[model samples]
Target: MLNFFKKKAALVWAKKHVLKSGEFKKNSVKNQEALLLSLVKTAEKTLFGREHDFESIRSVKEFQDRVPVADYEDLKPYIERVKKGQANILWTETPEYFAKTSGTTSGSKYIPISKEGMPFQIAGAQSALFHYIAQKNNADFVNGKMIFLQGSPEMEEVFGIKTGRLSGIVAHHIPGYLQKNRLPSWNTNIMEDWEAKVEKIIEETEHENMTLISGIPPWLIMYFEKLTEKHGKKIKQLFPNLQLLVTGGVNYEPYRDKMNDLLGGKVDIIQTFPASEGFFAFQDDYTKEGLLLLTDHGIFYEFIPLEEYGKPEARRLTLKDVELNKDYALILSTNSGLWAYSIGDVVRFTGKDPYRILVSGRTKHFTSAFGEHVIAFEVEEAMKATVEKNAAQITEFHLAPQVNPTEGLPYHEWLIEFEKEPENLELFRSELDEQLRARNTYYDDLITGNILQQLHITPLKKNAFHEYAKSQGKLGGQNKTPRLANDRKIADLLEIYKL
Candidate 1:
């Protein structure tokens, strides 16, 4: 009876909140400007606010003229002060906690989690579920356990401000009612050993009526593999009522086949674009091609055209001025007190009627080393098409440009850890090479003109990336294998495990 009531409540919440997201998009530009003004007004007395002259800024143009787009390097001083218990540096007063990010350039970064920004994060989380529920008409989601493969919630404090993995921080915030139906209790969640945690999670959830599962795509694959290995049955047999999958942090196109195959059937997969900095976007409609940007979530957004991103005097546009299909590097200022911050992500607008977008790639995560300039989306699409053509499954992969003449010619090198190796390796390579050439004219021009060598493939030993990530102390919790390294750092690391 209680479970039925909970399901009904979830349905009702879905209707109300999904409608709210719609309304939020309808007034995206105005709401975004208002959010920026409100944020500026609230922080008008802070050091950053004062330096940027937030008090005099009454419009987006004024704000743009006053503040330059900044990355983590530019804001490290203020973040350092915040970590040392300083108040009103980046944010007004001290933050309630900090979301520690695993940055490859640095060890980790403590991003402020202001009390004012918490509700927006929470709302985004709620809306993720609500959008999924509304799309699939999830009438019984609350009746069964929803297993979220999360990280350790045991937080460490720096000058009285608690910090841990971003996913762990979010895990600790899951509402009380849902907690009752959540799998992998605190004991397993805080185990600190990922393999052991998986074992314990299988034991704990093996008998439960699991309706939903959420995690990064690779981790979800790991859990499914473990479940099949231990139970001697498919995922559908293990949990007959499993309804849907919610995943984020990496593109799912590459793993989509294997994930559904392990389930013995097709399952609805909802994508989300949640980051430590903010919950930026979520899949709001089944009919929509891109994610609905959560415009009202205390975030003010700006976009830099990808072509002119690094140019000193390039232009920046707000939500109202963006065009469809052009890749734009995203910049944001939030109530969390990150001003004119470039989070390093790039996205493209897909639907302007409701401000829907697709996360195209990262600002630094691309291959332009010979002017081939291939992005993550193109690579992902190429890989997907190649795998489907070859009938294969991928476990993990990392890509880097091989520029030195040691190999006789410059080419893109792929280090792939496959779940099942292809029947004909050379043909798989050929298909991928052909597909990429078909997709990107610049890449094709290089290959066709014989300016660059053909795609060089190196099939890796099992768990190559997992071991590499472990070596880097970045093993789990939404941390992905860097898809494209700026140079040979990751490629050099993977050379040791070449098959």
Candidate 2:
């Protein structure tokens, strides 16, 4: 009876708005801007009224222009002040949760999250999920079971506080809201309680009809492989209903072929762009080329030209003003009290109205040592196409830049492990190099000057990247194997051979 009420509520919510994500996507920029303005007013009342005594912004342009840019480092002092049990610089109230992220350049960062912020994240995520379902007419799939391999419960504490990273916090709320019968009660519990988690997954494998699965690609690949090994041929018979797969947290190119083999075929795959900060985007339709932006959500979006991150003349445009096909650094101002926050992601606009985009790569996740700029997404796509062309299977891999000592050339070196070594390995490497150079002119220039040379490929043992990530104490939660290392430290650590 309790579950019935929950499902009924979810259905009602779905009917009210989620079913209209497409309509909402078609909403004009002028309408969305109006909605954003109204929400910003409400946010001011909700968050800053008591703290800064902010009544409202004098004007829309004032809100965008007057608020200075803030990065994670700038928030550190405010976080530290709150840690000492004092009033924070931004929010007057104490944060109910802190979503942790492994700092890209540093060890770790804990972003303070308020209760209001949590709901926005949840709403954005659910809207994205429903938008995809509605677009594909796959509403029937939601009635089935989904198994999300997630971070462990042991991960809740940071500096002795009972909490979790953003992903875990989101997972912690899933069971309460979701229809009980539709979801598998079986949880992997990937957190610190490994012994119990393994036992639980093993026990649940006996159940039939697990229709969908979602998790970090790397970890899920490892988990499925382990399950296959444990159950042998009986594994497929155990969970027969899994037809759709969702993966995020890392690039899926390296394990693409291996994952298809594990799943038995090319299952319907959807990739999501979510972070400790918020739900940036998600695959709305399999047939679509890009992710549809959740425009009605509380986030006010801005973009800065990619090449001009720190330049004073770097053009920043609001959602109503952005141009297509240009890569731009994402800047977000949200209801969570974040003002002009640099999210460290680069994206290109692919469509408007339902605003579609491709997450190009991180701002820093590129190779620029010898002027050969290779972004992560381009590399992932090139590798996937290469694998398909060669008809080969790759289990895992990492990429790093290698500079020629004598010629001063900078060429990319790939450390890969294939299911079966291909006959044309050198050709495959050349194809990838050529594709990259064609995509980014910097690589072509570097190659022409002997500043970048022929690419190198090195095969590794299976489970090499998984093992490496485990060794680094980065088993889960927004952690990824660095594909392109800029600094010599990580480059040296991941490099297989010297140039």
Best by lDDT, which number? Answer: 1
lDDT, residue 334, model 2 = 61
lDDT of 2 by residue, 111-179 (tens): 766666678677766765565554554444455566766565345544444467676677666645454
The regions of model 1 sitting more than 4 angstroms off are: 405-407
Residue 495 in model 2: shift from native, Å? 4.6
Clashes of each: 0, 4
lDDT (Cα, 0-100) at 406 in candidate 1: 79
Which residue pairs clash in candidate 2? Answer: 152-191, 156-163, 409-451, 410-451
Worst 10 residues of 1 by lDDT: 473-482
Clashing pairs in 1: none
